[model samples]
Target: MLKGRIIKALSGFYYVEHEGKLYETRARGKFRKTHETPLVGDIVSFQIENETGGYINEIHARKNSLMRPPVANIDQLLVTMSMKSPEFNYYLLDRFLAYGEAHDMEPVIVVTKTDLGNDVGKLEEIKNVYEGVYPIHFTDRNNINENLNDIFKDKLNVLSGQSGVGKSTLLNTLVPGLELHTAEISNALNRGKHTTRHVELVEVGGGFIADTPGFSTIEFSEIDKYNIKYCFPDFNAYSDDCKFRECSHINEPKCGVKSAVESGQLAKSRYDSYLAIHQEIDNRKERY
Candidate 1:
C-alpha cells in the first residue's frame, strides 16, 4: 500500500499525489457502510491497481476539517475582504474569523482593493479593530503585500471570502499562469458570480492553497451558544474577570468583556458580532 494526500475530488474520483506522481483512486466499499467520506486534503493509504489507478484502503487521522469547502487538515484560512466594491463589512469578516477559530484554523486577514479609493478613515478603523488581534495584510491588484509572501511556506492555506472580494484575482497574482476566472461585480446586485467550480490544491510559495467558491452566509450549526464565546479571540483578555465563571458576556453584571468594550479596550463591533452570532446559534437551537 502507498500513502498519499488527496489533491482534488471531482466526478466521484479523487486525485491523490504520492512522491510527485498523481494517482486516480476510489474509496473502499467499507467507507460507504461506515459513512466515511474522504475529503480533498485527506491523507489516505491506497492499494495500487495499475500504474496510475488505485483504491483508497484507509484514511489517516485529520487535525481539522471544514464542511463548507470540504477540505481537511487546513493550517490557515486566508480570509479575504474588499475595501470598496463589495464594501468592507466588519460583521461578515468577524463571522469568518469566528468560523475559522471554531474549527481550530488560524485566521489571517487580507484586505484588497487599496487602489480603488483612498479612504483613510475606513483603513484606520480596520487597523484599530484588528491590528494587534490578528495578522492583516493590505494589497491591490497591481501589488501583493510583501508580508503575505512568507506565511504560506510549509502550511496548507485556503483563500476564502464573499463574492467579488478578489479572491481569484489574488490567487492569480500569487501563482502566475493560474489565470483563474474573475468576473466584474454586477452593478445591480453588487455581487460577483461564483467562478471557481471545484476545490483543487494549487502549490504556491512551497505550500498548497485551495481557491474556494465565495460564499455570502456562514452557519454555526455545529456550535452551541455557550461555546460560541470561545471562538472570539478578542474576548479572551477580559472574559476571565467576569463575575460568574460561566458568564456568557451578555446581561451578566460585572462582565469583563462588556467592561472592556465600554472602556474602549475591546472594539464594540467585535462584541456586537459576538452577540449576533450567539443569537444566531440560539435561534437555530430553538427551531430544532
Candidate 2:
C-alpha cells in the first residue's frame, strides 16, 4: 500500500496525491460499516493499480476538522469577512473565532472588499475590535495579491468566509489563472452567491489552500456553555481574577471579563458577542 493525502473527493472516488502525482482512488469497503467517509485533507494509505484508480486502505489521524466545510488537519483558517457587502458582523466573527480556538487552529482575521462597499470608516471600526484580540490583515482590491503569499506561507490554510465575501476572488488574485467563479451579492439574498461548491486543495505560494464554501453560521456543537468561555482568548487573562473559580462571566459579581468590558479594557462588542453565544449555549442545554 502506498501512502498519500486525499486532495479531493468527487462522486464516489477519492483523489489522493502522492509523490507529486494524483492517484484516483476509492475508500475501502470497511469504511461503509464504520460510517467513515474519506474526507478531503485526509492522509490515507492505498494500493495503486497501474493506470486505473486505487483503493484507500487506511486513514491516518487528523489534527482537526470543521463540520461546516468538512475538511480536516488544517493548520489555520483565513477567516475572511467583508467590510461592505453583508457588512461587518461581530457575532459572526466571534463565532468563527470560537470555532477556530476550540479546534486549535490559528484564526487570521482577513477583511476583504473594503473598496466595494462605499463605507470608508467601516475598516477602522472592524480593526478596533479584532486587532487587540487577534492578528488581522485588512486588504482591498488594490494590494490583496501582494500579501496573499505571506498569509498563506508554510501552512495548510483554509480560505473561508460567508457566501460572497470574496473568498474566491482572493484565491484568484493569489493565483492569476485560478479563475474561480465569483458573483455579486444578490439583492434579494443580501449575500454573495455561493461560488465554491466543494472542498479541494490547490497548491499555491509554497503551501496548500482549501477554498471551501463560505459559512455564514456556525454552531457550537463540540463545545458546551461551561467551557465556551475559554475559547475567547480575551476572557482567559481575566477569568483568573473572577471571584469564583467557576464564574461564567455573565451574572457573576466581580467577574473580570464583565468588569473589563465595563471599564473599556476589552472591546464591548467582543464581550457582547461572547455573552450572546453563551446564552445560545445555555438555551441549547435546556432543550434536552
Candidate 3:
C-alpha cells in the first residue's frame, strides 16, 4: 500500500500524487456503503494494481472541507472580490471571512480590478475596515499584488468569490501559461459566467492552490448564532468587555462591540453584517 494526496477526481477516478508520480485510482466499494465520498485534497492510502492505476483503500482525517467544490484539507481561503464589475459588497466579503473562520481555514482578502475605478475614497474605506483585521491585497489586470504571491507558499490555498470577480484572471496572472478560461461580465446581470467546473490543486509558489467555481450565496449551516461572532476576528477585541460572558453582542446590555460601533472604533458595516448573518441563522433555524 502507498499513501498519496488526491490532486484531481474525474470520471470516477481519483488522480493521486505520490512521490512525484500520479496514479489513477478508484475508491474501494466500502466507501459507497459508508457514504463517504473521496474529495480532491484528501490524503489517502491506496494499493497499486497496475503501472498507472490503483484503488484507494483508506482516507485520512481532514482538517476541514467544503462540499460545493468538494475539496478537503484546505489551509487558506483566498476571498477574492472585485472592485467594480459586479461591485464589491462588504456583507458578502464578511460572510466569506466568517465561513472560512468557522471551518478553521485562514482567510486572506484579495481585492481585484483596481484599474476598474470606483468612487473617490473607496479604496481607503476598504483599507480602513479590513487593513488591521486581516491580510488584504489589491490587484489589477496589469499588476498582480507582489504581497499576494508570497502567501501561497506552503499552504493549500483555495480561491473563491462571487462570479465576475476575476479569480481566473488573477490565477493566470500569477502563474504564467495557466491560461484558465475567463468570461466577460454580462452587462445585463452584472455577473461573470461560471468558468471553473471542477477543483484541482495546481502547484504555485511551492504550494498548492485550487480555483473553485464562484458563488454568490453562502449558507452557515455548520455554525450557529451563538458561535458565529467568534468567526469575525475584529469583534474579538471588544467582545470580552460585554457584561454577559456569553454575550451574543446583540441586545446584551453594556455590549462592548456595540459601543465600539457607536464610537466609530469599529465599522458600522461590520456590525450590520453581524446582525444580518445572526438573523439569517435564526430565520433558517425557525424554518426547520
Reference-based TM-score of each model = 0.91, 0.87, 0.91
For each candidate in the order shown, give its overall lDDT on alpha carbons: 0.86, 0.78, 0.86
- lDDT, candidate 2, residue 81? 82
Q: Give the Å shift of residue 113 in candidate 3.
A: 0.8
Per-residue lDDT over 1-288 for candidate 1, one digit per residue giving the tens place of the 0 to 100 score:
999999998766889999999999999999999999888899999988987678999999998887656789999988989998999999989999998888788999999999989999999999999998889999998988888888898788887778788887888899888876686533123233222235688898888887554344578877899999999988999999999999999999999999999999999999999999999898888897
> Candidate 3 residues 151-252, lDDT tens each?
999888888787778887888887777777686533224333322245678898888887543344579999998999998889989988899999998898
Clashing pairs in 2: none
Give the poorly placed runs of model 3, Cα more than 4 Å off: 118-120, 184-198
Between candidates 1 and 2, the TM-score winner: 1
1-288 per-residue lDDT for model 2 (tens digits): 899888887778889989899999988899999888788889999998877778999999899876556678888878888886777778787888888888888888888876775665666777777777888987776677466577667678876667767777787777677676676533225333332235688888887787653455678877899888888998888888899999989888989888888888788888888888889988998998
For model 2, the run of ten residues with the poorest summed lDDT: 187-196
Lowest summed lDDT window (length 10), candidate 3 = 187-196
CA lDDT for candidate 2: 0.78
Candidate 3 residue pairs in backbone clash: none
